[model samples]
Target chain A: LAKTTQPISMDSYEGQEVNITCSHNNIATNDYITWYQQFPSQGPRFIIQGYKTKVTNEVASLFIPADRKSSTLSLPRVSLSDTAVYYCLVGAPHRYGGATNKLIFGTGTLLAVQP
Target chain B: DAGVTQSPTHLIKTRGQQVTLRCSPKSGHDTVSWYQQALGQGPQFIFQYYEEEERQRGNFPDRFSGHQFPNYSSELNVNALLLGDSALYLCASSASWSGPQHFGDGTRLSIL
Candidate 1:
């Protein structure tokens, strides 16, 4: 399992963009960087995932450099509802090609979106 | 389609007692994983079950054990629990060990 480091907390106002970076120096070649969001009393929700370069979804975008050692999650137009903890995980692929079931979560970046 | 569902949203237990938490995976999901989250901390993996067998485990002790049934529903059992065992237990299910795992709201266990 690859360990990830991210900011403990970030503050943003409504309509602003937020970018949280995660460092995973030991990320493996088969690993995929994934991000999740968690609101209080709820499970973490999948935001975006990418293997390299950039991937964008309806909610957020993931930017990974060629080094693969670090990645950033970019959220546009922050709102109070977006206030939650964001987790960055490096998915360790199983020898059989499927990703590992074990998801290691760190403290995560708690993004407080102010109105 | 329904996502992962866990039973007994809240539970109260005492030290040395045993507790059981249940989870039903999302439709078509064949693997279930358990995690424990302490207040102000990220969730820690407990173990995962596939094919009605314990496949992978984390750093959790033997006291924290789980069982997956043929239907893919699972049960987590903790024996001789301690005060430190008080936390939120979350269950996540994935499809064939691929893609993102859907999670339940988690069972809040308060050990007194």
Candidate 2:
């Protein structure tokens, strides 16, 4: 598993766009970048994932540079409900009979959305 | 339509005591993994279970053990618990080893 580093915290206002970047200098060829959102007292929820370039879903967009050393998760029109810790994970998707697909989480970026 | 479910949403045990936590995977999910999350920290992988066998585990010690049933339900057993073991235990279920995982609310264990 590639070690991921993210900001300890970030602040944004409602209706604004928030981007959290994660750095993984040792990313491998088969590594995939996945992001998760976690609220207080709840398990982290999958937000988006990408291997390279850009992948956008209804909730967020992931941008990966050609070097693949770092990735960014962009949340548009943020709301108060979006306040949570965002995690960046680097690993390969699970293959049958393969190593366990356990996600290694960092301290995560605590995104605080203001009014 | 039910997501992953865990029993005894919260538990309290004394040091050296044993505790058992149960989890029922999300519908159609065959793999279950357990994680330990300490306060103000990220979740740490404990182990993963597939096909009713222990597939892989993290750096946790044997004090942390688990079992996966044929029905895909799972249990985490902790013996000779220490105060350090107090944390939220999360159970995640995935359709395949590599697919997106769904998590349950978790069982909050407090070792007093």
Candidate 3:
């Protein structure tokens, strides 16, 4: 398991771009960076995932450097609904090839999308 | 195509008592993991089950136990509960060992 560190909180206005960075200096070669968004009283929703470089989805984008030590989650055009805690998780492949998805979540970055 | 589902969205129990939380994994998922989340804090992993067996556990005490049924559903049991046990209990299900795990809304347990 790799530990990740992200900002405790970030503030952004609506229609602005918000980037949340996570540092995982000990990330392994088989590890992949994943981001999740959690709203109050709801379960965390998967936003984007990336092994390296950049991966864009319908909702967000994940940017990972070649070192694999850090990654950033970019959310374009933020809205009030985007106000939630964002979690950065480093997924390490297990011996079984990709069947154990156990995750450790630290206090995630609270992105407050203000109006 | 329903996602992961948990029963008894909310529960209340007194100290020294026991409570059981149930979870039905997403279709085709075979692994289930449980987590505890206190107020103003991120979720803490409790344990995980694969192939109907306990595979990994976190820092939770022996009081926190779980079982995975043949159908991939799971039950989280907490005995001798204390007020500190009052938190949201989360259940996540994954298709493989390293892929993304889907989660349920969670069961909010309040220990009195």
Deviation from native of the Cα of residue B63 in model 3, angstroms: 1.2
Clashing pairs in 2: A94-B98
Per-residue lDDT tens digits for candidate 2, residues A11-112, read 999999999999999999988998999998898888888999999999999999999999999999999999999999998767546434788889999999
Pairs of colliding residues, candidate 3: A98-B97, A98-B98, A99-B96, A99-B97, A99-B98, A100-B97, A101-B97
lDDT of 3 by residue, B64-99 (tens): 999988999999999999999999999989886445
Output the chain A TM-score of model 3: 0.94
Better of 2 and 3 by DockQ: 2
Assess each model's interface with DockQ, reporting 2 decimals per model. 0.59, 0.65, 0.63
For residues B9-107, write the lDDT of model 2, one tens digit per residue.
999999999999999999989999999999999999999998888988999989999999999999999999999999999999987745677789899
lDDT by residue (tens digit), candidate 3, A1-115:
7999999999999999999999999998778888988998878888887899999999998988889999989999999999999999986635463357578898999999888
iRMSD of prediction 2: 2.0
lDDT of 3: 0.89
Task: Give the range of the ten consecutive residues with the poorest summed lDDT in model 1 chain B.
Answer: B94-103
What's the DockQ of model 2? Answer: 0.65
Query: Could you tell me which residue pairs clash in candidate 1?
Result: none
